[model samples]
Target: MSNNSILLIDPNFDPANSANLSLLVKIGADTFSYVIIDQERKFVHAVYDEQECEDGYEKLKERLKNDTYLNLKYETVKIATHTQNVVYVPQELFNENEIALYTKFFADADSQNIYVQPSLQQNIYTVFSLPYSIEKIVNHNWQQSIKLEQNAGLLELAVQFDKETLIIDFTVGSFQFVYIKNNNIAFNQNYQFEDTEELTYFILLIVNQLNINMKQVAVNVCGIINDGDNKWSLLTQYFDKVEILTLVSDLDTTILDDMPAHYYTSLLALQTCG
Candidate 1:
């Protein structure tokens, strides 16, 4: 176990059945977390980095190397991240020649580093990027890599709710807001804030801009938030129905008894995507 990382392993994890394992990794600017599960959707092992590392990818790779269980081949691997260079493209307007369209919305698009994920809606797709070196590390370690998703928080939120709803996912120093209306995505964005007030202001701005009825739309929150936290209290004041997001019902939760299920909502949702 790494000094700065926390590991939780299910008592019944079977090393002999490594072939049934699937790994889900969530990499962020300063930290990373991963969960390993068996084919039955039962958690095998999980780890979270408590302190932010300047070289998070390197540190994570080192930890993975040292952990004997993690070295085994898994049935599938999925990686998700939050990157600024992401753009949503409608299938009708997207073409090879228009790859540069991402730059129109996000100024930092590197032509050589782009990746795309087709959405459940045939007409929509998402374009994003992962650092070349990090992508290489993931590829080298897990040859069965399934898909890499950018702004995965929003993607997870989009599929969880089908009606008019507001979803918020919180991380270390930032949070993501996703609004879904009429079984379609209305607005999706990420924001950084230093305190509860800044977060509140941003939410208000989005509500006004989208003309959302705060009273009518339900707000679902997940990630690093707790009921007693200031952000939770503040959100309750503006929205009549604010609730913490819940994990998919089919997943086994015996090993996660000590932690809030909402914290792993995004990782669980990744299993549903490509």
Candidate 2:
């Protein structure tokens, strides 16, 4: 199957679309294309399907003949593409800490590998892709580590008991979620969301259903929708404690504004562990 990915074309080039052209060479992606969506959602430039790849430098130059404005603005066409590729991770390559984190993350899923991500913008931990067998082992061990982290003040302590840790993620369109538990007792549920409004009611429903005090709860927000102050300030109405978390530091600022959040997250994740 063709991989689904997002491409970021050079802001300078109009017709060269050379950025996309170059990616086709490096990744050998099955399909290639570009869509320029303005604030008005108007198409400024575009190419799709078979027309995605370029013939050669000469041909690419010819295509940009009409892109005189871009010619004056930039020297070369640079583009960024987000594509999926089968990634492999040897079990022994990861430590018990990393494996434990993934186990708590995957819970009941069965997958060979896991995607370990740390967000630069939000500086939060994200674990994706895990096999069921490893997940159980990791989760089991994570509970033990969590007890240590909490006692050592590494984890949120206010709601470390029977209550749940409410996660309101505003990172992407569709958020991924998971519940971390301690035996039969469930202590936390991570709620991933593109924006708070989309799942605001659901959060309230859960709070009411669980009969949580909300004030004693901890809320973690990520992405552009919720700012450092707003992430905690607004949630203060419902949560006793609220904090903003990011896996990246100030040095990683460039990538945050330059790339899409998910792409940035994946790249940052790779960079940190590498």
Candidate 3:
């Protein structure tokens, strides 16, 4: 495990007999994480999260080579590869034939492995790119074609709550703010922030531009930030219904009782339905 990694595996989990289990993997520029779930029982068997690797890409590939649990056979394998070069196109506007036209907007398009994830419910297609080397590594291990998503777990929040909601998923230096209106994505983008003031400004600007009433909208936050952290503090001051993210599932993940509620939002969102 990396220096600041989090690992939790149930005592009863047996890697040798994982035919009924499901594997969920999340890879990013600086992190690699995976979760094992007993699909039949709706039980969480294992959760391994390692972040902030100095050589994240290389380290994760090495882990994929040596990690015991990761190589096991499972009912299915789902991966979420995070990338900033992503564009959302409405169903009517999406052109599968002209994919290169979309890549023209990305500076590193030539070096990326691109894939599209569609949301039939929302009627939009999320087109994203993953670095060729990393995507190849993922393909080598999973032995299956992978569907990559960038901040798409956030849409699960919109599905969970049928209200005016603003969901912010935070990382070290950036946050992806997704606002849901009329039960679909109205505004979605990532903003770089150095401090609470910068985050506050971005939220205020987006809210005003979208005519979202902070008092009426629900603000659910997750990831690196905590309940009383600077960013969360600032949000509570400006918003009325501010809350940390909760698992949108009925499964009894008793192990999570000791951990912070915000720790696994996007990671677990990879599996759980609204």
Candidate 4:
């Protein structure tokens, strides 16, 4: 964790009771966030951290070794990671044997681990891949963890709520863009941006091609962008409906007091994965 990372927990939270809490984690090679929620869907503990991609794996190892809350036993564990190599197959058409054909999730087929992510609100199966090392670390740390791609959570929200026609999630060096039309994912991809110019090009290409109504688009921006940041300035200027995404309404978010609610909306939404 860095100086800017944030961790919060209810002072009265009982360590013995963690057996009933559900752990939801959103992770990437470089960034990680997780929440411990009770059966009532209340967030009791949360942590968000980021660093250079090279150090992410080390950070994960350190945190898991030293973080008491994370080491606690949980009734359920759900994890989500961002991957651009995704193939959406209908439930009926999904073939477990053929899933191995999805580009080895961008790795040598033998070195990659594939995951099939299912959604309650959508009929399609989100099949994606992650490095074998990443999956090994996660599964080794927490037994029986359900895995999902980040876009699965974003798409789930779009289908269930019929809102946020487009969502943009920012992280350390990249951002993911999801466009939902008619309650289905139209476009979802992650892009690396070295400067605002590169980001503007991608955003404009999508907006111009879709000819989206800036007024009614329901553009929600979440993750790392801050007020007046280059990404923030570009987005607020591009869409009239652009705004920081709010945390899900189903849980008590007062745990986030004095924190940026928008920064973790995507991580909190992984609750939908469970």
Candidate 5:
């Protein structure tokens, strides 16, 4: 990891606990974050770093080579940028050949850079991907791995609660909005924002497009935000019930005493995908 990277390690972390370690690496456009969980599903150590695309991958490779805890039995690689596409296909009608058709939704079908991941949800398949750089780096490290739906972590949050839910996962230059109604995914989209006004505009645009009753739907937010930040205040103007996302009830979060739990919610929820 770079010298500027922010890292947090639980005081109780022990190398002997490697047998139960599970790592999650989330690569985004301008930043990357990772979380390590122990056998008992407790947060062991985590890191969040800001770097250019190529530099971030190089740092990750360096970390993998030197970080003792990363040599664990299980790891999950998640690409969290907007470079990919998400298409819902009926389970019975889906086929490997159709993967190319879905790729066309976001990119040229002939592009070699495209990769597809189909996650089954009852009767539908949520197909998503990792960009070529992300795919190359992750595959080079872990030959056998799973491609997580970009919204999988958010979906985990949505299902755990019984309400019309909207989750906004914020990062450096981008953010993702996920809406769940009646325990099913209604909409999921990512956007780039230059300021709070642009961000608020997009949020209201989605709200109007979805015909969501702002007063009734509960908005749960996560990722790099705080109580009195401009983004938080803007969101409050539209949502009366806006609140930080709740961590999964089972994990031990005592190690996160100094940081807002919402900031690492997505990283922690990634484990639920397993």
Candidate 6:
């Protein structure tokens, strides 16, 4: 194993980390996950979360007392998501400074790689680039041959247009709208909800508030597909061109195991790029 690699630990046993890469080992009360991305190359070196521990920590310690398994050492711990369960590995593994240096290595729509650091946190008081208060939603013309950025295991839905594209973030119960026109952002909206009904209601409310007719819009239902239930069946009743996305043509079909409802949407985004 490379010294510059780290592991992620999960205590909640949430399936969300299943798609994430890096060294994911389920050791009793914790799970480990990690991913190495080449932002410059638009590629990722990821590890699957299928690693297992041969012996329990307590058992390992007891075995070590008897000089059984040897050479076990870990250092440099970090925590992600919930409260205070840390992931530990070698200290020299993954320099934070090196990660920061590659943070700016991103590509533009023209496929030109540029060094730009993403905002670690959004500014609350900053105004939108253009002064149009997006109090309502806007629907532009739709196209089938549109291309979009692939979600690195993130659930994403996008509606492409000639002038702009509307991308929806549906990874969680809440919703976030990001609009890009002429390769520039036009508007953003965020909404929180408790259930799918509220989520659908919020979508309709946004459309009505923005004076956008449902007939002219296309909705993609993603992320929670194979729960042995149909969550998007209701969407067809509201929109004329609703689509349920699946994997791209190039991906292996075996990836369909543990298919989340939004997996189809992720596949659609990948298809756009293809």
Best by lDDT: 3
Pairs with backbone N, CA or C atoms under 3 Å apart (clashes), candidate 1 = none
On TM-score, the candidate that comes out on top is 3
lDDT of 6 by residue, 1-274 (tens): 2232222222232333322321111112112222222233333233222112232233223323542111112111111111111111122342444533332332212222211111112111111110011101000111111211122112222223333444453433444444434433334455556677887788777767665556655554454333234235545566666655444434333333443434334322332222
- Report every candidate's CA lDDT: 0.72, 0.33, 0.75, 0.73, 0.67, 0.32
Estimated TM-score for each candidate: 0.85, 0.32, 0.87, 0.85, 0.81, 0.37
Q: After superposition, which runs of candidate 4 have C-alpha atoms over 4 Å from their true positions? A: 51-55, 90-97, 101-105, 111-113, 160-164, 208-216
> How many residue pairs clash per model?
0, 11, 0, 0, 0, 17
lDDT of 2 by residue, 1-274 (tens): 1133344443443454323221111101222222232212222232111222322222223323543322322222222121121121233344536555445534354555544433222223434443344335434423221101000111222123343554443323332221223311223233333355746665676667766666665554433334434434546766777665343433323313543342222122221221
Give the range of the ten consecutive residues with the poorest summed lDDT in model 2.
145-154
The Cα error of candidate 4 at residue 250, in Å, is 2.7
Better of 2 and 3 by TM-score: 3
Q: On a 0 to 1 TM-score scale, where does candidate 4 land against the true structure?
A: 0.85
Residue 57's lDDT in candidate 2: 26
lDDT per residue, candidate 4, 1-274, as tens digits?
4664668878767889888888887766557677888857565565555544554456667778878887889998987875555677666677778876655555344445666777775556788776577778888878698888866566666664475478888875678788877766667677776778888898899888988777788887788888898888888787787777766656876677777888777777777775
